[model samples]
Target: MSTQNYLVISALGKDRPGIVDALSKSILEFGCNITDSRMTVLGGEFAILLMVEGNWNTLTKMEESIAGLEQQLSLTIIAKRTEQRDRSNPFLPYVVEVVSLDHPGIVHQLASFFSKRSINIEDMATTSYAAPHTGTMMFSVHMTVGIPADIHIASLRDEFMEFCDAINLDAIIEPAQR
Candidate 1:
């Protein structure tokens, strides 16, 4: 007889070289296969999200191995089985992009707006880069937000436009289908 397996692990910590090496070593120690993974540095923080698979009986051992790594690297780790469902289902998946002069509170304002409306943000990637010629900072946020089928997209667009106007930034919201 064979045991079933399922799990996803994600980690985030201060950005530094060798973090990936440490994480890979830990994963190897646990003997878990990396099914799929993505890692990136955002605003001086290194973040990793990975899907791992192994026998159910070894799940705790795998988690323990990663927990050791977390302590060694001062990382925050989150692990959950694949069967666990995420709360909040915002209808259809859509992408919202905003590019504007970098300033404080941009993410807060946009996220606040969505939260107020019960929108589920699946994934968001935001970065600040220098503007060409001007050398000033510009912020770019690409968010995958969930929109309910019954929700009026036009109204959302209108509200986004108004919000963009108030913040002096350009916001674009569109349905994201793969």
Candidate 2:
């Protein structure tokens, strides 16, 4: 029977134009398929996370070749075998948006609230900027969270709104469009 191996690979290095090209070259040469990937520039560094799949021997070849690529590109590369995960879940999706005066404990507070409820954050992005006209520092957070299907959305929304009001944040929690 034919078998496939899954790998989760991560790389970080100084931002440069050819980092992706160099990694893609090695991945191609090793005959592995990049199933999913996320690459971003954070500060002065380019970071990459990739999910790859291939036959056992092809993956072995990649493991051997990555060392050379790491040295040539001056990157920190890590690869680990991972089991294919079931992405389907029984949770309902919600989009949460928050805007408030910049403060240190905003993220921590939100995370604690969600953690207490057993909610799962699927993706989150946050940023800070000066508010228009006023020039006041503002923090904005946008996140997709999975709420357990058993929870009543109306009650949960009421509680969430109360929490936001207590914290002086302008927030909205709404159903996410698929």
Candidate 2: 10-residue stretch with minimal lDDT: 81-90
Candidate 2 error regions (>4 Å): 87-89
Q: How well is each residue in 1-178 modelled by candidate 2, as lDDT tens digits?
A: 4398888899999998999998887887789999999898888999999999999899988887778878998999999988686566699989999999999999889988888999988778889999999999999999999999989999999999999999999999999999
Q: What are the lDDT scores of the predictions, listed in order?
A: 0.84, 0.91
Top-lDDT candidate index:
2
Worst 10-residue lDDT window, candidate 1: 83-92
Expressed as tens digits, the lDDT of each residue in 24-119 for candidate 1 is 777767777777788998879999998877777677798766667778889999998884345465388889999999999999999998998888
Please count the clashing residue pairs in each candidate, in the order shown.
1, 0
